[model samples]
Target: MGTVRRRLAGRALSGSLALLGVLLVVPSLYSPTREMAVADREHGSLLSHQWEWSWGRVRVAGLEGVELRDQWNPFGLAVLVVLLVSGLAGVCVWLARRVTWGHVLGLVTVGLLTGRVLTTVAERLGRSLGEVDQGAAGLTVRTEMTQAGSLETVAACVLVVALVLMGVAAARSTGRSTLPAKLPGTPAAGTAAAGPPAGRAGPAGLRPVGEHLTTAPVSFDDAGAGGGGGGADTPATAGKPGRTP
Candidate 1:
């Protein structure tokens, strides 16, 4: 019963982690990790851009006067790889009805690293944009991350927390399954009561029994009857009877 319960709990945790992974992927697809704005000082026109990262693609959208450029960075690619692998692992775990600490750790690490990398990339992109020369055209560029409560950030946090919780649950289940079960009426170690008082007889003249013995006691009356029969047939008794006859 305990083993069954533990397996069920592990499966539940795996399912939860999978759900979290899917949720995390959704926000990554639609939410912009960073926003960029380019302005022509002379023309007074501002161009807004949004960068979104997903499993297989990177999206850049220009909301105003400039054309969006397609670009990829090493860091962005690495983050994408982690996201894809973690998402797939989660799905497999959910389907297989199993979960391990390694899976949980992978999910957690991916989540945390994704957030960190997003921040770092955003900062680097912002810096690079600020340094670009407009080539005699009065142009300025600025970049900023999306709001704190952006869906991507929220999803990443949720995924990380879910993985941590799953790991903890799996660990607890494993610990419980490995422990030995205590049987009913069994004394705990170091506290077993001393056996029935020494030399005290049990039911029907039986010796006091411990945990293992179950034999019935010998009959004292049967032994006495056998002894009397043997005495009646002794040599002296036979001679006396013959002489009287």
Candidate 2:
């Protein structure tokens, strides 16, 4: 028990160190756009502008427009979300067994898609709250929100596929059971088995009653003085050269 505890402790310490290392490494890899966006939120009024427009047309049932003209918080929020998801993915990978690598990988992919969806939600909320202003500088602006080049459409499809795969994999991993390769007995199938062999006991119960059990008592003199039959005999009965006495 002590040895197993020590091994687990060591592994946990190493995993923590690796996580700290990643915390130190990721920011250095971020793109300049992310940095500038973060800067805009902190030092500029980009975060002060958010706007949404709702217009109806005879041909269109519902048309919604969002404008983040000066909204810069999206960049910072995106970076933060990415960092968080990356850290989560790392932790998931660490906690996962090697045999479940595919499941873990799928989980991380699903998380990425979910994060993107969350980003879209945040942006939509910001726009709805009138945190931005919208207008055309010179040319006519498209007031309709059903543009095909929007990021939301891409994220929606990705999220749908990722969620379906995640659901399938998670169901298989949690809703079913399979035996290990070594044990070939029925008792090894799962936890719901009869008690161990009658004579034997598990870690929690009585030991077996057998010849291997020691029930005899020994006095100090008999053990120390070596006078009992259990120890060496006198010289006469010890042996004749190599012959048995």
The best candidate in terms of lDDT: 1
Cα lDDT of model 2 by residue, 1-245, tens digit: 77546544543443444344334323322311111111132333332222221110012121232232332345545665565466556545644535556455545644554565455445544543542323232222222223221334344444555455445545554544463655665455455466566545657664555646444553344454556674553332222355322
Angstrom error of the Cα, residue 72, model 2: value is 2.2
Backbone clash count for every predicted candidate, in the order shown = 0, 5
**For model 1, the run of ten residues with the poorest summed lDDT:** 236-245
C-alpha lDDT score of every prediction, in listed order: 0.55, 0.41
Error of 1 at 241 (Å): 16
lDDT of 2: 0.41
**Which runs of model 2 end up more than 4 angstroms from their true locations?**
1-71, 78-109, 112-141, 144-149, 176-245
Question: Model 1 — TM-score against the truth?
Answer: 0.48
The digit string of per-residue lDDT tens for model 1 on 34-120 reads 555667778767755545443323445554545566665566566655665666565465445445454454446545544653564
